[model samples]
Target: MPHQQTIERKTARTTTKFTGEVTCKGGSSRGIVKDLSAAGICFQLYFDINATTGQEVSIKSDEFGHLTGVVQWYRGDKIGIRLNVSSNTSAQISSYYKYFR
Candidate 1:
């Protein structure tokens, strides 16, 4: 199948260590964000065997702020999250855009 539309403005994801949470069918889990973009994010978890693929999740970061997302993929202690919004996100995103540039 063909890929969907792009949402992120940056190709290179900036490294970020921020607290976040994931809500799945099993429940919520506290994790750390590895990096982030307007479209998606990567998590570095303490446990490797909690979440599953295709699970709907919501994540909130101190730096990136709150976002409703879904688990696109997962492997080991790392999971990929696709953000829900296409445009008009929080001020934190704009802050990231300015600081990173």
Candidate 2:
């Protein structure tokens, strides 16, 4: 039997920039998505969209569709959100990564 190489799964991904929104404890704010994967999404906000780690929110994009996620990380105005609805459209999103790189 031949051994198959283990493909490491990565949630850190880049895709075509899209207009999106994130709703959390602070409130909903408009932002631009830098990238996305089955696990999470990284976004950039022009202004501070107040939020914190583990905060649940809604993320919507015309091209990628809607998703539920939690705030995974943030630095300054850039943030990463871990997706709860990772299965709905993972394959579709994974393909988008090629354009971003």
Candidate 3:
């Protein structure tokens, strides 16, 4: 399938370090949230995980509560997720970036 092209914009991607967990079809692993935005997130996993593009995932963290996302890409121990969030959650993420980043 032809992939959709994404544009560059001023979406705030706040650098962060927080413990979180990701669960997918392959399994689960602990990870650290390296960066976050209203649209997506990138995290560093603690161990090898079998996540792949378009895979559905669930993330749990103290700061953001529970979030559902789709794996956008992965390389080695790092994974990028495009979040499927509600408007309220998107606003909250933007607020966090504004106040903290």
Candidate 4:
């Protein structure tokens, strides 16, 4: 097999273990926000659900309001999502970290 390299296309903010929840058309899953950025976010669900790539989702928590995004990737119970909103999402998350951390 040829060696493969994965390139990161987005500038990810510093990782933070923030708790949150994700909801889809089928149901909802609780998870921890592992990494966050202006373009996307990465989180790990406490329990695996029937989630797949290209699926639309909504994430919400006490620190931030409902965020709309689409699932970009998933492995086991961890998932990466690309937000549909503007870059303001990143600023809000960054501010939350600075004040709450």
Q: Could you tell me how far off, in angstroms, the CA of residue 2 lies in candidate 4 after the best superposition? A: 3.9
Query: Per-residue alpha-carbon lDDT of model 4 for 1-101, expressed as tens digits?
Result: 99999997757565878899998876789999887877788989987767789999999977766788999998998999888867667677667767876
After superposing candidate 2 on the true structure, give the runs of residues whose Cα lies further than 4 Å from its correct spot: 1-9, 89-101
User: RMSD of candidate 2 to the true fold?
Assistant: 7.3
Candidate ranking (TM-score, best to worst): 4, 3, 2, 1
Where does model 1 exceed 4 Å of error?
1-10, 88-91, 96-101
**Number of clashes recorded per candidate:** 0, 0, 0, 0
Tens digits of per-residue lDDT for model 1, 13-82: 7678877777777667778888877677898776554677777777766665667777888888789987
16-51: candidate 2 lDDT, tens digit per residue: 478888877787788899876667788887667688
> By how many angstroms RMSD does model 3 differ from the true structure?
4.7
Q: Which has the greatest lDDT? A: 3
Model 4 residue runs over 4 Å out of place are 1-3, 87-91
- Model 4 Cα shift for residue 82 (angstroms): 0.4
Per-candidate TM-score against the hidden true structure: 0.70, 0.73, 0.81, 0.82
lDDT of every model, 2 decimals: 0.73, 0.75, 0.86, 0.82
Model 1 residue pairs with clashes: none
Query: What are the root-mean-square deviations of the candidates from the true structure over C-alphas?
Result: 5.4, 7.3, 4.7, 2.1
lDDT (C-alpha) at residue 85 in model 2: 60
